[model samples]
Target chain A: MYKKILLATDGSKHSIRSAEHAIYLADSFDSVIELVYVVGGEKSKEDVLHSVDKYEVKREREEKLRPIQEQLENAGLQYNSHLLHGEPGPTIVKFANENAFDLVVVGSRGLNNLQTMILGSVSHKVAKRVSCPVLIVK
Target chain B: MKLQNLKQDWFGNIKGDILSGIVVALALIPEAIAFSIIAGVDPMVGLYASFSIAVIIAFVGGRPGMISGATGAMALLMVTLVADYGLQYLFAATILTGVIQILFGVFKLASVMKFVPRSVMVGFVNALAILIFTSQLQHFEGEGWIMYGLVALTLAIIYILPKFTKAVPSTLVAIIVVTAIAIFGNIGVRTVGDLGELSQQLPVFLIPSIPFNLETLMIIFPYSLALAIVGLLESLLTANIVDDMTDTESNKNKESRGQGIANVVTGFFGGMAGCAMIGQSVINVKSGGRGRLSALVAGTFLMFLIMVLGGVVAQIPMAALAGVMIMVSISTFDWSSLRNLHKLPKTDAAVMLITVITVVATHDLSKGVLAGVLISAIFFAAKISKVKVNEIVALEGKKKVYKVHGQIFFASVNDLLDKFNFNDKVKEVEIDLSNSHLWDDSAIGALDKIEMKFEQNGIKVTYSGLNEESKHLKKRIGGLSKASGH
Candidate 1:
């Protein structure tokens, strides 16, 4: 039932596990993966959002995506990489909804409870807000 | 554009300005008296200073909608001056302070604004909000739950009523309704009269009798300098916050000049030095005040409160004012700052935290700003100092190419120096720098040293990727000056 799978990662241990599961699902279903990373701040509107300096984000994004990119390459699977910015949870949900992604995947914990308590919990808020099917992996 | 059109642009929001100014003037009375008490001066001095500043800044200020008046930040600095040197010297110092602020404006003190990082700005606003909120809590004391109930009701009316009526501001309506209720019901609580007695007399011109001389100037110089710095900082910062709220730009240097001129006139009128008040400015903006007329009206209304409406003003309950200011503090705070706390760079978050703590602890805006700038600068220097030299031993027609792939500055020169090995088995060495930028003399010096050592070892040295800036600076410093043309 999936076509475009959006894998959202925060480079946490739970996110790495989610990345692996998303990759496996993509392989089995023979679908393209929309590998997305959202750099967060509070500059998010209902739909639109602004970004900070993207160069540094680009560098870190590359490093975070290297392993997943290699696995997809080895499996001969096609994928697209996106580095979006805003409040992380809303940005991800909005991006997925606007792009008509078939399914969404997230880590069970994003930077732990303490960190998310400030910006808010990405996975919990995404589950509450998004329209698409979500798989919150541990 | 025609002059009429220009005038329209300047005074387009006259109605809003007048309404907002009246509300601010009403709000300023108790605050001015309280701050004057803090500075150990007669309450009238604060009232007169606020009046003078409000009127003067209306004419010359950069921010069209901002309100300037006697502020706690200015009062905190004046406590020492008023104590150490008598009121005569305080007046002399206030005049000198104005002159110094005018000099600061002439020198374009606004240029320093570029260095104040975004994190510090948020911290500053947030701290001010906290201070205002907590300060209002004291007024809530002994008034009991009934007072709190009134505060809540007042806050509710201020926020909820705007949806129904847009003619009169909700805040002013709230203030009027709550005060009327408190007085009609004969509530057992503090009123504006308890804050300080406002005289029903006009202020007359009184020049400073500081015996104008070298020794007198010297005695007042330090205090004047401190006042000038603190006042400008408060005014500029308040202006910036208001600009954000109003979504308009301000002329920073012009604001500095206006504040200085206002202070000078205030001193002659027997008022203490003053600056922009953030709390009152927020109240103005929230109440739809949007032009110079608002400031003028605020000042004029203050004089009216003293002479014509003293009885009515005194009857206004402190709880009502407290509720209004409590609303101001709540709205002024940057709630998004807390939400973005975890997402911000740790260094930036640290700087913001430290700034807020310092400002609250020291009660000195200037010191807090300095601490934030200093800490941010040090952290920024440390991060930029991580410029690295990447080695790429690629064979380009029998030559070894070593590429440096980061910014080259004094801090990174040693890294570049330590990475070079002259004994690399090659006929020539091409240092590729298409990705690197040369920032200072030391970097070029390091390159020269590398070339010299390589040439001595019988290997030819050449640069492959000198960007325009690198090439220009290199040529200017003789690194490539004698070698080639741009």
Candidate 2:
């Protein structure tokens, strides 16, 4: 039923796992995979520059995507990677809504509904407000 | 060094402070009298208490702009004391209550006040408002037309005068106009003088004869305890309000100590009990009261009114005073908080309701707050206990990989530890955080103890998806750092 799957990543280990899962699903269905990464706006310029310089953050993001990209290349699956800057949840939702993706896959930390409402989780917000089905892989 | 800070300069920032003092003085006069009357003491005692406490708090308190004096909560407390023990023993009780507050402050017990739930505060305020309104009903009797006219005039002045001018305090204007008409304009109204004579001298030291006996102490101790709690609550709440309004930090312990000193002094000077007065402090802030000058000026003004213009002050009708108190009561009720409480969890709502009902029915403010705190703690404990742990084993060939689930804490520590079984087939222990989301100090300590015990048994423990807190615990314990490798 699913065709184009957009996977959002914060370059975290969990997001990498989600990316791998999205790639697996896309390869299985012979569907296209779109990879998206977001940098939070509220963070300082120095912090953003530092993250880039450290290579730790970039390595994790590329490491997660590189394997998937290679696999997709081997399987000849249509794929693209894009990076944007803003708040994680809202930016992801807005991107998904505008691009009209069929399925969105994300990861959850398994925080309860009330706590997630307080210390808001991106996956929880996306699942609650998104128009299409959202799979939150914990 | 202290004097240098005090005497730095009055012309620059001090001008604003002086202006604020004048405005606070204007606001405090009516309030002092109104609160004293609520306590069933001579109205002059209220004025005296305000003057004494305000000056003392200004110098000794840690927070600036928190005008400490006779407050509504203390007023409500005094009513029961006055009714049961008469005015003399009420004074004695105030002295004893002051000693208790002093001890609490000395022990630095002010932080304990934070455990008072927000729901309880809302209930206390609403109940106090009802009590203040109820007490004012006495003045509204007999001269129905006059009382109605004064009330209507006060309300009009409060509503209309603020729209035209910011210089004139609407409440002060209401008091002045209503009082003048009641005195000279042939208005058939009951003046303050009809109730009692206004005293002109400064408060004198009066040793209360407490009839030093267990029976007397037993009779008065319960009342004193209630007074201490209400006094502490009101003072701390006022300190918090002043902190927000002024955007300044306060030493809660120091403020409590200052309150204790002020009350003890008030009791010694033959004045009624006092706490931090919220209305006057707000007025002081809005009117440019920035420092100790505002409080000092208010106290000076109150003394001046009593000594020089005693007769003029006496002309203020009881109905007019009642009108002023009704305004104060409405302000203290916290209508927005009451509305928000309805939106909170059912348990919170129930606690809030119980506090309100208990306070109203028993006329005991402390008991209500205590009941609310007790309920809130129980709710918290129950929630903490609900966090469960699961044990899972994945068998591969001849070895079994053990996984532990749930956030471990003191509440769930024993259950989690008990679930672990040492067997010949179990080769590896993986404390899994994939499903476990969080940990507290007790849980970390528990994990450290378990790891030591496992090492003694020659079994190794590895972790997966160890979240931030558990990762910190691993670093602290010098264990292998668990990182999720991409």
Question: Per-candidate DockQ versus the true complex?
Answer: 0.03, 0.01
What is the lDDT of every predicted structure here? Answer: 0.76, 0.73
List model 1 lDDT by residue over B1-486, tens digit each. Answer: 667744753588877777878878877876776667567677778888888899999888888778888876677666667888778887878888999998888899866765777677667666766766766767766568988888888888877775456456676677678878888888777776676666667888988887878999888886788778768766776775565555466889999999999888888888888888777886787666878888889998988777886567666677777777677677657787788889989998898898889878876556676788899999987787665566666675457778787878887777778788778777888888898888887778878888888888899988977989889988889455224321
What is the lDDT for B319 in model 1?
72
Residue B362 accuracy (lDDT) in model 2? 78
TM for candidate 2 is 0.66
Runs in model 1 with CA error above 4 Å?
A1-138, B9-14, B37-40, B83-90, B133-197, B209-250, B277-289, B311-327, B396-398, B452-459, B476-486
Model 2 misplacement above 4 A = A1-138, B1-3, B8-12, B391-393, B396-486
TM-score of only chain B in every candidate structure: 0.81, 0.82
Error of 1 at A72 (Å): 33
Q: Model 1 - which docking category? A: incorrect
Error of 1 at B164 (Å): 6.9
lDDT of 2 by residue, A27-52 (tens): 78877778786655222121221131
Q: Looking at model 2 chain B, report the run of 10 residues with the lowest lDDT sum.
A: B477-486
* Candidate 1 residue-wise lDDT at A101: 82
